[model samples]
Target chain A: MIGVELRLMLRRRRVWLCWVLLCAIPALVAVLLAVTNLAPAPGQGGAFLSAVTSDGQLFPAAALALVLPVFLPITVALVSGDAVAGEASTGMLRYLLVRPVGRLRLLTAKLVSVGAFVLLAVVFVTITSYIVGVLLFGFGADAAVGGAGGITSLSGVVLTPLQLAGRTAATVGYLALCMLAIGAIGLFFSTLTDSPLAAALGVLAFVVVSAILLPLDAAAGIRFYLPTTHWLAWIDLFRDPILWRAVREGVFVQLGYIVVAFGAAWANFATKDVTS
Target chain B: MAGQRFSRRWLLVAAGAAAIVGVSAVQLPAAALDVDAEALRRCIRAEVPPYVGYAEASGRLGLPEIPQLESVTTLLTTTTRIRSYVAGADRWRADQLTGALGDSERDTYHLGAAEYVWDFGGNQLTRVLGQAPLRLPRAGDLLPPDLARRMLGLAPGDPVTAIPARRIAGRDAAGIRLVPTDPDTTVGRVDIWADPTTALPLRVEIAARTGPTLLVSELLEVTDGPPDPAVLRPVVPPGAGAVTASAADLSGALRDLRAPPAPARLAGRARLTLPSTPGSDLPGVGVYGTGLAGFVLIPTGRDVADRAVDGATAAGGTAIPVPFGRAARIGTPLLSVAVRSTGRRGSLLIGTVAADVLQQALLELPARGRPS
Candidate 1:
């Protein structure tokens, strides 16, 4: 089942290449940012550096901004949306179901592969962008935190740039689960649709709506229930004492979405008669 | 299809989200700036000690048996003045201050006797100490933040007044009263000290909201006032006391001076930069003052250093002149001392020099209306 899923995905290399190409912008931004430290020509160097340094507080926000566009549910939808449709359009689903193998396993293997793709895309974006940012803007030995509670500061506890990177990496990783949850929804959409366009657009609509509704005052009590709000939970790292409650709650929310979507998809796929 | 249902729900969600953010943005509270600024100003006023002017001396008015001289008078004055400190001087008690401090003490600062005038008649000797005429307190002396820390949470409109008491010149002399007011607060009464002879108040005092309480113990004020305008103009009279000394000896004798190299007067001569500007160098020096008769800007440098002038002219009534280096207009309560001319970096400003020293210079002024 896994081999068959792999072969089918490989056949659609053009669309996958397009997905990687779509990731090029944030990757390039991360690279350039790492190299130049964002310092401009000598005359403007001071001003440019000041501007960049001012963004110290904006670190988590920027990470989310880069990941939200494509590495998220959208990618999830694109890959998963193509799953059943691509197979059916190629006239292969009927041949596969004719085997003794359960239809659910075949779809599960496909779901796992797409889930790996979503995880790798998110992890790469976070690492590459951070490395590029640190390289481009000399991460002064420390970062300054201010506002509400007044000025508090923290930074690299030591020679371990890796350790510091690891801590920051954890924050991005927490955000990644939101992307996977979006992917799960996409996977569910993929199993039900015969057209890849319909599945991908369905996932896209949910993401756009979540982003818009999260900060709305009307939904304040329940807005945090959304995936996009948890995407921002990464910002908790910048707060004093690092409020991980939101991050933790976000994990549960994403997991809940994934279990429900997967459970519902399995049940649907197990009973559906695709023989026609 | 799941896609169809999800798309519809997502569309409704997106619209709701935009509205949530917009309302939250408007609801955030803003800080009040004006109140903070006023509080800061009050802090500066209360924290920075008021600049003071003072002079101390010992002498007899007429020939006494044990005295080697017919009469002796040790006179001292300063421009490190709290406005009411001058009034404090006129009051009876010699030690006191009352009034608003200048607004610039954000850092450490000291007010010194920058000028002095001395004279003697029996020895037929007279010397002039004519400095280049400069005395601006060093920069870091008045940092606002430090002053604010020292004077935070002071009572509003804190003001003080100083007045004279019965004691005069360390002993019991009479003839002045002084009053001090704290512009920072209006709660307390003006301090008063009096002298019967001149009927002038000798000392004034008040409390800073931050430093002193409304209670009486911490009150501070200037002990003397209404300085003879010539006090800071740098000059000494010919036939008054009995003495002779070099500018160096004078500098030593006037060791308590708040200003150094004291503005040249009856002692000797040297150059002085009054913290006027970065590259200010005044070549010629003198103390110009107006008295009961008229205003005279006497050249008191080495060559024409024979005579000295008081900031005040005493006829039946004394005309007091104030110094302002920015302009050369002289009148009562520091009319204005003009800058002679600009030089290397800037010019010499007469009034810009602290006037409490001029108050000491007054004793050296020829009784009044004497030949230059």
Candidate 2:
């Protein structure tokens, strides 16, 4: 059942379009920077943006920062929101349910497919950004001489190319987990209505409200539980000692969201009346 | 069958609600523990523990920005978040976290005799060579333990009494209040809370006699053990720009400008000799008094002084009469500054003393080219 869901997702034109648009943004940014030779002053632009001009190897991290704020979440919401509601709107859900597939198994398959899309999107962005970064920035000055030149951590400690690769891989994994939590919430919304747009809008509103409340002092009491509060925790992975405090909290928060949202989705779908 | 399914759905909702309540319940205040106030005070002064912690400090003094003092003004009027790892008095590292989301960081590592400063935003590492007798303030100075210890050391004669204990950073902390009896001092009271067992200060609050609280620094989370040694050692990255700088360079700039010498006595207070250290005996700078009531006198160029006075006046400073020139005074709840211009040179007097004290000191400053 999960294989069928994956195959269907792979063949969709909408899914392919999302991947292309996501990959195009970082490539466009690299062209602009290479042509103009102007990088924002240090600490002025996105996280690793200023450093990207000096060593393009850092562009993957900058690319993630550029998209994490809005682009990535929006795509996740759209794909996951349409998981069940899209099938229901086209009158495919009733026929599938009549087949001997249990509601729980069907919901599980839909969730697995959403999770796959998230991983695919994150991996594609990381790989494409790396190619664009090195082609424009090169391996920096020391790499040419076979010296110790590599990516510099936020703490001013040098990271070898291998270590930089490990950290970048870790960043991709952390972000994939964050997006999975959002997908779980979107799946829950997908079970609420037959309209895919309504389900997607519901998930987006949840994210927007969380983002708005995260910065308010009065909302501090509830900030810890907000899913959006720890979105930037992956930045800590690039630190020299790798400050794990925020990253650990972020992992726990995202896990909690996944468990609760998935549980709610299962409960609602099992008893949900599908008259259509 | 349908009824059983409905119960299952309700069960999931109940479990989610329970999880949130349980998390919030863990953060509720713990009951305070009884402790001897005097014993805790003595323990804090005598026993220093090695620990690692995260702290937050905020000041509401609203100090105006001035040239060459922008850092000082910001430290006194804004919030600072610091992560500190301490093994001893000389071996420690403080990382000041900034930016809207606390993503940017500047770290200072103090080894036995060497100091290194790393800027994450600029990707630069600086090794400080020497110490400056009079240095500007930094984020590390606002750490709860450091700030509490310094304030206690400065006013040793002040009376100390017990205040109600409170919970801080998940610890049952005992509190002490220090009230300065000196009429000339502007500080009203200082409240410090510490762990009774280790006497490590967890929180410090300072306020003026007649105004609102001025500064509050507290440890948000802490652990009671020395951090890994490798964490305190800063390695300069290969591609990072590394440079060596002298601490005295800032003060040396002032001395090269050749301002007038400071008076030996101002407002009946004799000039206090600074501790004799390398590069500290800069001529023409005077430190007055020996306690929290004391102030420093620096002779500066007329333009710098004028700019400071104008900044202060625009921030609600008041004009004051002085010998042979003009003077203006500005004050927060706990700090006072007076700038006086005499001929082509001027003097700046600043301290945690009363505004009138600065006014009297400014009146006694001699005109340039005149004998004291």
Candidate 3:
């Protein structure tokens, strides 16, 4: 299954190139950020500008702004949106179906590869950003707990550079989970169409709809529980005393969506004839 | 057994004292309107109009106040000079404001100062720089013990305290209040005047022992968002050619100049009054007296310039007090300001402390001559 997935990916150079670009863009951005401090000087009103601009926004608009609209969704759509369609369009999927491998196993392998690619893409972006951030921002005791206790930690806390990297790794894990739902939806749609562009576009269209709906005056109640809303769960990484409730909910919701998406794909692909 | 009994007795005594102190807090006279330091800090940020200190030249509004633009730029400046070891050649000019000190590369830093510019909206530093007729946030009655006491009975050299109340500026205020006092005292009682709708002060009447100095400051302009960065730059203007760096000059820290404005005089019969309330549409009832010569009651939307014009319109061999004092000036003054946060207990006084840096830089200014 791994050999087949590799062959399939290599056959289409554009997909390979996209994976490269996805990693490269963030790395380049990280480099630029490392070279210069984007924040203004201490006294010249820079701090206020940084603080006041935040809203009840679900994501740190800065990181997500760079990631979601451009990288994550684009990558997801390219891979998941083209899964079944690309195979059908190139006429290579049939030869495999006639082989000994079961249909379920075939879908599982492609999905795993898609999952691997998503994790790889997110990890690269995370590491690149971290390196750049550390270089430019320096490890200046990131926070000074100026309360009456005079900055002692109640629990064990880590301060070494290596520890920071570990902490950041956990944060990236949370972010990757948030994007999983987007990739799931794309995977579901990949089975719905024969044209890769149509499928890819369909995935983006789904994201755009949610993005628009999230802000309208009516997105309360059950509507707030939409898939993309969970996509913004990454901001939980920054809050002190991390709100585990929100993180737990986010994880479960994406898991729920993944189950439902694959369930639908299985039901549809299992029964429908693929003669065309 | 005897030692244990003694220790227990002492612990009980300490506990009793703690209880008594707790009871005193509940019984304090100001308990009804009493706000903790944190609540007061929140109020201050919420109520006070964010202030931005700006002073720059060229391609922007210079420190020079415009004739009458219906706005103002609250600005302050600070400067610093540092000398470091040179690597190969001493190429860095001493006059230029450059160099990172933390790394310690022997790069000398000179004229390293920053300006805080609050445009129309009146930011604590940046947030409200654009919206005009600003109704500053109420820093609340959460002043520290000394400041609260000083604010209540403000005197000359005492800091002034202000809060936003509904009465002053109609509807423009979130709740606006302003007070002015010397460095010695934090603001005590502040008279707030703002049109809630316009958020502009109709009058800001400050009561102090030195006589109530009323600021009839008008929101002449509110250029929303940040002022132009170039306007915030401290560099010399075009054709203001840069001077060469001096190696032998350790006089970098020496004061460059001092030019506090000469006290302006009012005509002997001139009068300035600050009516307590119902003082017209002004933000407060604060008034300014020019050495007791004459008094003019300053109302909101009425600049001293407007008052001067009004005095002229009255057609009299009369006198009007100069607005905003005599407009103080100092030539290339060097300052050393220390900002101690009054915002939170330990959260650096982000907004209020900006003033300290500016104040310190001006304190140890250089004399009249350029240098020895």
- Best model per DockQ: 2
DockQ for model 2 equals 0.41
> Candidate 1, residues B169-229: lDDT per residue as tens digits?
2333221111123321222232323223222323322222233322111112233334333
Write the number of the candidate with greater TM-score, choosing between 1 and 3.
3
The TM-score between candidate 1 and the true structure equals 0.38
Q: Which order, best to worst by DockQ?
A: 2, 3, 1
List, residue by residue over B283-351, the lDDT tens digit for candidate 2: 567788767788888777778778888888899999886656677999887999998877887778888
Q: How well is candidate 3 docked (DockQ)?
A: 0.03
* Ranking of candidates on lDDT, top first: 2, 1, 3
lDDT (0-100) at residue A42 of candidate 1? 17
Task: Judging by TM-score, tell me the better candidate of 2 and 3.
Answer: 2
By lDDT, the best candidate is: 2
For the second chain, the TM-scores of the candidates in order are 0.19, 0.88, 0.23
User: DockQ (Cα-based) per candidate?
Assistant: 0.01, 0.41, 0.03
lDDT of each: 0.39, 0.82, 0.37
What is the RMSD, in Å, between candidate 3 and the native fold over all Cα?
22.0
Candidate 3 lDDT tens digits, A1-276: 877786766577776677667656644544454455343332232112121111111112233335755577887888888887788777866776888987767777777767766776677665554454444443322133222111111011212334334445665676666566666677778777777788889888987887788645356454435667666444333322232444566676666666556655554555446664
Quote the positional error of residue B135 for candidate 3 in Å.
12
Cα lDDT, model 3, residue B238: 16
- In model 2, the number of clashes is 0
In candidate 1, position A162 carries an lDDT of 42
Instruction: Give lDDT tens digits, candidate 3, residues B1-372.
Output: 655644554455455545534542333221122223333333333342321111111011122231221122121111111111111111111111111211011111212222121111111221111111212211111111112222333333323233434322112333233334333222223443333332323333333323433222222122223333322232321111233322212111111112121112211122234232221222211122322111221112224333333422343212212222211221111111111111111000011112233233222222221111
- Identify the runs in model 2 with alpha carbons over 4 angstroms from their true place: A141-149, B1-11, B28-34, B58-70, B73-79, B99-103, B163-172, B182-188, B207-216, B220-225, B250-273, B276-372
